[model samples]
Target: MFQLSLATVSHGAVASIPLILVAPFALLLLLIATMPLTPPRVKHLWEHYYPHIAIGLGLVVAAYYLWRVEGGGTVIGHTAHEYFSFISLIGALYVVAGGIHIKVKGESTPVVNVAFLAVGAVLANFIGTTGASMVMIRPWIRLNKIRISAFHIVFFIFVVSNVGGALTPIGDPPLFLGYLRGVPFFWLLDHVIGQWIVTLVALLVAFYVFDRRSFARMPVRLRHESEAPDTWRFDGMMNVLFLGVIIAAVFLPDYWFLREIVMLGAAVASYRLTPKDVHLENHFSFGPIKEVAFLFIGIFATMMPALNYLEQHGHEFGFERAPAYYFASGGLSAVLDNAPTYVNFLKLAEVSASTGGGGESTPAAEHAAVHQLLADRPELVIAVSLGAVFFGAMTYIGNGPNFMVKSIAESAGVRVPSFFGYIGRYSLPILLPILAVCGWIFLH
Candidate 1:
């Protein structure tokens, strides 16, 4: 059995890490992006053993870091902590939100579809994108079952699953990671709401046009024509109360351990209290969350040395402008986990801000960079935050909800695009243009 020794990890003397160590991570991204395009047999074998591949690569990366620097241990410890908090939050929300089943009798008209996504946008800020997706996806699917298309799910991924989560920390994992690192919980709302609203509005308008055009392309006989109900019914309603308890715990002062325990208990209560029949109807299973939990282990570990290396030398890459930061974060986020990427760039920004003004940076200046960052935080933070959240919609694995929403749609029989297909067809032609506009409007 392969084992990772958490105890052996320690931050040794400050040592510069070589850039060569980033290859495994780059290769991992390449495999993920290109495998589906390979021949069927090759893709099948690769997919079947992808987890093993990820683990092997992660071990190799970790070993390299361990041998090279004492800081490897610190990276491991911090990663474990971040991974724990991340998976716990995801698992809790997935379990609890799965308990909720919203039923509204309606025909899935273009207008109605837009409304559903809009509501999801608002709800995501509080319940989180993953939870909001779980709660709303089934109903949206049911409403559009008659004329459902991949485009429906794609647009939903854009508006609800990613871009909509920009307002609060709980809204998305990357933002929440920032919160854990002493960023104010409400910082995104204060700094990013303008960009969020503009981006969301443009996407919504674009979706309406696209959906209308697509609907018109389909045969008239195939479309379901019905109105949204004046009222809606929610099953497993008590879980709503439990959801509140979990969110409240997030805001609790002190008692970090207690908060985690209560959150676990709350998740348990949700599972036990929710009817099995509801789960069956919702097609709720632990599969998606389990897959995420497993895959992200490699993500956090393999990313460690890369992150550490980036922290030391990131500013040297010469991405000095806010737009550059925006694109750097968002572009990678399209193909990678936004959480670590967010942290990587955040550290870069802080370090750069802390450095001497156009001169050699001293230790005291570097130490003071953190405070300086927060003072005029609006520009860098806005760019990074929006970039991470927005481009995370570009692919299935870009963000947690992107995958969850895809899995749920597949379970309901909507065929999502392949990884490259999503970017080439949906995200590139659709989201990319909108993102350029957002950059023009805000990041510049």
Candidate 2:
């Protein structure tokens, strides 16, 4: 394995090394720079596309630098493989939204233990929270087609998009990191359910408050649309089978490559075997998923240096002095991407503590024993995971599905808020307060 010298990586303070710390803002600038080059019809496209593109470019540049200059000892292919694996996983889930699972009752509420809940629960663990969000949100909105308030959409984004999927390994990236780090798959059940409950309750409260207002304001004489064919109706069930193949690729990739390829081959064959009206009717465009995957590729690549430095020396910067590390890491993660954020903090915790079993950490230390302590202190994993997954709802760019939701909502002619406007109006007022409670309940 290749490693950069801690001395070399940390030589510049977080602020001085622009790629490590300032890259996100720089990337945003590049996006702004490129907007005039895009066509007017696609002006809307730039708004949704630019941040992600900048993030991906930044990641690529960072990865290239580490490989060539730092002798970071990682192959480009290895990193790219890891990078696109996330994209593919995200794409597969994006394609089969329901395969990721989200429960809804009467288009607005979700009941525990019902079939939809069961599907959502299963998919949330299998694909990811965002994957589940993309699949469920559209259907959910359509189910409540009569509801016209924007707050309803905003609330749905809050609960289903952010809070609901924090529990299982596949539900969120941070938890997946925990699973990779030897935390038992079911560990979240014991540690995170309380936090999840608080989030769900907050969602329910927001739903009731908003739903009542929306119902009252709904027009008394709603127009029925022209006699267009129902999109929900399908001639081919094979698309569902293809979606299933994608899910298999997600949770059990090795198995998917092995015997599961046979299943995938069968699913594709079914696609050809099915009628054109069915498969082509809902031809899944690569646009939304591609935008997210590509953009995040840049973010992960560019942020590597920052992540390395933070892991080696973050405690010296007074993270331990603030209750805000949980929020800070996660808040930055909303823009920077959470996978690396979780790793950075996990490494920081590892470096700051003395080795003891259970969730306890000793005073800060300079020795490798701190790494051992981090290895042992799995409870800290809960905090890191919770922080990354939950706080991702802080902004539209926080996670991929968020941008997708925004795009879909806009395409449907629903008025959405601007980036800052979104935070001020929708996320801050509704989601951030809930996140604050979650942080207190989970961290304090």
Candidate 3:
């Protein structure tokens, strides 16, 4: 069944990392997942000191790599570069999207809400889940302000911020990493579009059920107020140019951080030029992005050891079936940064495919292995790709846009579930089964 021998793959300096180094990442995730459930004073302390906690944990890992491991500085440097690129794109999108305000004056019936989410889902493929979430979330809240609840925010993350972006490289970061690694631009659209539609439809239907209940619970007068005819006014239309610049900047050469520079420049231009009234209407602030930025520093840094461990040992899990890869990659993607998780699993799939005799230990060989896997076992590739993008909605930390959407919703006085509450209430009970059925039907 195996095509290539695992011995052909190189572990490099990452092989020397001890399992103990994973503690920092684990600790950080635990804190993030549970802190909000703590007592009021404790939760307040966590909010006040989260930046220091996150950065301190990140520094610990950085110091370990700098002082202890061989060739580790290079790994840390690459991670830093990745982190900078990540935050730059996210921050730029946040700033640019924040400048454009969409005022929705209309009814927020279940059908309208579903259509809105469907549109956001489609928009996610073009502008990215982060961009789509930033641009669409406030409007969503305003549309549903009469009866918004935690489920509204959770379902928004499900449809718009994560699963909606499975169709294109621009839709999600993990897919872009696949594109960079030689997957065809339309590979996902070709292979997984059916499953994408199925999953999206399932989530949307589930959302409609919840929303119908929510709509019914509203008093008759409030329901009438929410169901009134719809009108939308656009403000800060000039920011669209800045958004286009940011999106175009994604394709710029990575040399000297040109992409990040262009993105940030556009963001600064948008922030400075946009009217104060638009910002006021949008209730834009730096708080949500600031929270995402500092926390992700810890997440990206501490996750290196976990990712490294997976890279060095992933094949031993004996994942011979597409379903195994689906759940394994999806399970990890739910917690770790799914971009690197997707890449590592892609490598594992490549290694698994090389057992039939075409294995080598070079960068070119690795690239070729990806094509080989694509040509030979495309199902595995689809499974991994879907797992990474789809399961990213399973938790607040699962995707960059998830937390940002939550923060934005909370800032607007919408009720949002706590981190664990998000999983226990919506992810496990609602989202997981839909994803699982999709995986079984498609990948199994």
Q: What are the C-alpha RMSDs, in order, of all predicted structures?
A: 4.9, 7.4, 4.6
Model 3: number of backbone collisions: 7
The per-residue C-alpha lDDT of model 3 at residue 309 equals 55
Better of 1 and 2 by lDDT: 1
lDDT of 3 at 4: 16
How accurate locally is residue 291 in candidate 2, as Cα lDDT from 0 to 100?
A: 62
Q: Which structure among the candidates has the greatest lDDT?
A: 3
- Residue 70 accuracy (lDDT) in model 3: 60
Clashes of each: 4, 14, 7
lDDT for 65 in candidate 3 is 72
Winner on lDDT (1 vs 3) = 3
- Judge candidate 2 at residue 246 and give its lDDT: 56
Q: Candidate 1 at residue 405, lDDT?
A: 81
Residue 108 lDDT (model 1): 65
Please list the C-alpha lDDT of all candidates, in the order they appear. Answer: 0.76, 0.55, 0.81
Show model 3 residue runs off by greater than 4 Å. 1-17, 176-185, 212-228, 335-376, 403-425
Better of 2 and 3 by TM-score: 3
Candidate 3, residue 231: the lDDT equals: 97
Candidate 3 whole-model C-alpha lDDT, 0 to 1: 0.81
Per-residue lDDT of candidate 2, residues 35-152 (tens digit): 5336786778876666656765665565555645433334233345445555555555555542222223333322311233335434565557776666655655565655535665
